[model samples]
Target: MHNNLHKTKENTSLTTDSEWAITHNNLTSVYRLMGDLSNALSHLQIALEIRKKVLQANHSIVDVSFNNVGIIYHSKGDHKTARINYQEALEIHRKSLSTVHPRSAETYNNIVFVYDLMSDYSNAVSYYQKTLKIQKKSSLSLIHPDLATTNRNMGCTYAALGDYLTILEFFEKGFNIRKTPLPSAHPDFAKTYKNIGSLFNKKK
Candidate 1:
């Protein structure tokens, strides 16, 4: 990977070129998968810097760069910084894409995830609501995996908020959605069953 990076750098006329940024972004993914978070962040920051210089503020690619950097920060346990970057991505999406774009929903989901990590259940629920609104209005099928995931996430957040009834509703929706495409033996079914079992225990 280091040799590849060297070769990429050598081939580029300027370090700030888009191709160089793409190479850094690719390296960031490799380092992240290897659990070398420091190097992952370093590469992503460089990629983001190059993207900022080469792209407009509301460019879709710049939004993607921000979201990727946010994911890295989230993996590193920096929820605040992750939220900041996620919000930046969301703002760009809002400015450059449709209100109900999938990218905006994804960004909302990212912010909700950080809020959940921070134990800010109310905020998580709020953002989750926004995510659902966009997803529902978008072109995604009713049984899309993303919708199921969001429903499951909402159930978990509602559980944290002590809204057992709402949790059951969301959980049931998610479970039903998963039932169509996934086999009975799928791990996702187990997870849904476990969540429902835990919900019942909490209710008792």
Candidate 2:
């Protein structure tokens, strides 16, 4: 992917506008998955630039580019920059998509994650609730993976706030969802158990 993307860059005159953005975005994802956030950010920035040039300012693809950049910044622990990028993405998503769209919900979840990392539990809960509202109104099932993730994130936020009862409720909801669909050996399934155990230990 790296070599292909670099070759595409070298032959920029041969690449179409959409092709350039797509290749850069794909490279960004590859780098991000490898935890090379610096390269991920660089590629995403290039994608964003290319998209901004070829696509409208409020294009959905532009929103995705911004969101990808936010994810990289969030993973790098630059919560401020992550929040800014997420807000940018959210604004574009809200303008271009329905309120209950999956992308909007995902952006809200991303914002919630940043708030959680910043130790801003109140804001985290607020954004998590937004994500939940959207997910519930959408076609997603109660046991959908995204729903489970939001529930678990809410659990973590409540745990941080010392609301053990609410934490347990949310965690149990998420755990039940994962347990029904995921194999016992799945990492997510194991994580649910671990989270429950940790919360129980905290209570004790």
Each prediction's RMSD to truth? 2.8, 3.9
TM-score of each: 0.86, 0.77
Give the best candidate by TM-score.
Answer: 1
**lDDT tens readout by residue for model 1, 66-161:** 998899899999999999999999889889999999989989999998999999999999999999999899999999989999999999999999
Write model 2 residue lDDT over 80-132, tens digit each, in one string: 99999999998998788988999888888889878887899999999999999
Q: lDDT: which candidate is best? A: 1
Candidate 1 lowest-lDDT run of ten: 5-14
Instruction: Give the poorly placed runs of model 1, Cα more than 4 Å off.
Output: 1-13, 180-190
